[model samples]
Target chain A: MSMNDLIATIKKVLEEVDVVLGWTRSPAAGVAVPARFHTPDEADGAIFDSTCTHNLAVHLPRLKNSKVGIVAKGCDARSIVQLIVEGEVSRDRIRVIGVPCPGVIDVKRAWRCFGFGKKIEDAGGRVHMEGRSMPREEILLHKCHQCQDQEPVIMDLAAGDVKSVTPPPPPDKTGIRERFAAMSIAERREFWREQFSRCIRCYACREACPLCFCRDACSMQTREPHWTGGQVNAIESEMAQQVRTSHLAGRCTGCEECERACPVGIPLMLLLEEQNRIVEELFAYRAGMSLEDKTPLLTYDVNRDGGWR
Target chain B: MPKTEVKIIGFLCNWCSYAGADMAGTARMKQPASLRVVRLPCTGRVNPLLVLKAFREGADGVLVSGCHPGDCHYNEGNYYARRRMEVLERMLPALGIDPARFHYTWVSASEGAKWADVVNEFTRRVKQVI
Candidate 1:
């Protein structure tokens, strides 16, 4: 939908909720950045576009005490629904203003190609920045290219015609996915060692995750059990990520926030995506698809689950 | 330098696998000396992290044994453990650990000989991979 429709919907929702979580144009970044609009007047600046990539639902659990309104794109809605499924936020406590997502682009890639602080726009299925244009397909976030949920899974209000959004093109399998598949198990271990060694132990991936709502009790940094150490070496970093990945086994919605937030650029989604696929294949479940859905790991089938053995 | 022998960590449920392992020990069944056993209250208590921690601490392999399905001391602990273990086992290869380095199985308190077989076979498989 258009920016006017997005802002109007946020404005309408702001009347009832404590704050409307949406995006606003950032002059410094030359793209949309997440903003909280507490009043209808503030909603005038709320915008949603291809550059609006943050999943605002990450704020829901932290704001559990407040009646919040969120502007969710299709993938973000999956996270919202998954959060609801996990009972992180009560259904009535939040209002989801669903935007028919036109697929968000990788702002980092855009900034790399067009230069930073240059106004970026998406029109006619092409991204334009500094008078240069690239095909929209070239810069769409990796998650968006494989997006199966163009329609929000749940919403209290629709910002635009949900059906107007088209499906993403089939994923190109030649890059990281192919490389990962090509690597043998031994090679993968070495690959992860080298990749994780570059990690600065910033924990940005955990912070950006919408499902990692465990706040102070997160085992990633806990010393009582000492799941991972504070050392910044590859082993400790890998173990820290192992804790995060295992915790997210049946729950991660493949939002790709962790990868985006990771300053060191660890391909964290490769692990999460593989786990999500395995969970789907083994249990016939996808996290956050429905409110009534049970988490695959929390439940079991007495007579059925044996192929992994 | 060449490694001398494989080190395998075994997490055995207290009610069954642990007792079965005790039975194996009392019976003097000859099995690989590679496994170091840690007993927990139930298979459900065997968090996948413990296994990962064993691996990270330089254990060559990890094994989890519990009561047979529908026969857990806590009624359904192994049922839940089954799913978690399966997910973790499948995840090992993706994490770059050889999936064969990890295993999970059922062993009842009465099945002492069976426990010997389980340990011997698993230890053998781990030795081959290492």
Candidate 2:
């Protein structure tokens, strides 16, 4: 319900887990940055505000050997659920402190508008910064504009008022969505080619993905199979992204971390969102929704899969 | 612009489609020369990326052929391959490849005639698109 409730919950959870992954306000950045708390005393620094946009579950897979306590927003919890279903993290070894999200703001967007490192706050469905206020809907992350889970999907401990948040409104069928729908297959090919031409191949998109936990074994950079070339040109970059999008066909949770992390600002979500939509339409399945779900691509229903043909 | 010869990459499962193609060849069945065959153990080994790679390498079309759904040599390989191919087929359009450029179908070892007909139709279809 409040900052105290979030801190108190994390403190309680810290007793049972080795580390609690949450957000702490940064003095220099003037926004919430992800931090790990090891003790009840460190939990005092934990805060859950609109600026706490980082998904803490990205840290869970790397810490497979230790018990972890994660402060999960509704979207972050989906990533955690997916990790559990994939056997990357055991559910029992981790504690989930669910924070009923009120849709986090895209702090970079805010900074771009209000000037960087300004005191930004969210209150009464609006974002406030440096004596200027704007409607919260105008500054929220694109993922938040279409958020389906205001309440965490799975939680061992509830930290905030789960009932207080309302579902996100339907997204406007304009901008990228409308333009994407209007483009033909040939046109889309050109669009993506032009877009990927600017890619520097930094691999920030891969690194920020919570589900892309392949680390050193990632095929994106593997030289043996030589999936993509070492060059940073349009063809190689586009193929690298194709590898990512195809591999994430049924597993991506639409967290948009990959797009957000991309330094060159490639709209990676366009490919991912399209694949997610196709997966849902064909199989009637949404990734990371349940622990029992086998990835649709990994399994088959011989008698029932006729419509796709 | 001058018309280019359509180059199709055919990934055939060894037990059925590959043998079926061999039979067609030995029978001297008249078919287009567009398709080049790569034989794999089963359709299950036909990863979707292989299809994409074929396209990237300038294959005008890709055809994956295996045993009929209930008749895989491995009993279940084609069943799994069926789902993957279906998914990959749906994704082609999104990647800007004409959906008509890729196809997957079943061809039993004895169906030499059927294999010839499939190759004729698919190559004709690919020629139309390119």
In the range A1-309, model 2's lDDT, one tens digit per residue, is 789999999989888899999999998888899999999988899888899888878899999999999999889999999999999999999999898788888787788899999988888888899799998877777888888877888899998777578779556432886787789988988988998999999999988999999999888999978899969898899899999998998999999889878877788998888889888998899999999999998888876885564
Model 2, position A83, has a per-residue lDDT of 95
Model 1: residues with Cα > 4 Å off, grouped in runs: A307-309, B1-4
Candidate 2: what is its chain A TM-score? Answer: 0.97
Q: What is the lDDT of candidate 2?
A: 0.89
Second chain TM-score per prediction?
0.95, 0.97
Measured with C-alpha atoms, the lDDT of residue A211 in candidate 1 is: 95
| Candidate 1: tens digits of C-alpha lDDT, residues A1-309 | 777988888888877888989999998878999999998888889887799999889999999899999989889999999998988889999999988887988888788887878899988889999789998878888898889888889989998898788779667543988899899999999999999999998889989999999989889899998899899999999999999999999999999999998998889999999999989989999888999899988888877876555
Per-candidate RMSD, Å: 1.5, 1.5
Writing each residue's lDDT as its tens digit, candidate 2 over B28-97 gives 9999899999999999999889999999999999999999988999998988888888878888877878
As for candidate 1, its clashing pairs are: A82-A288
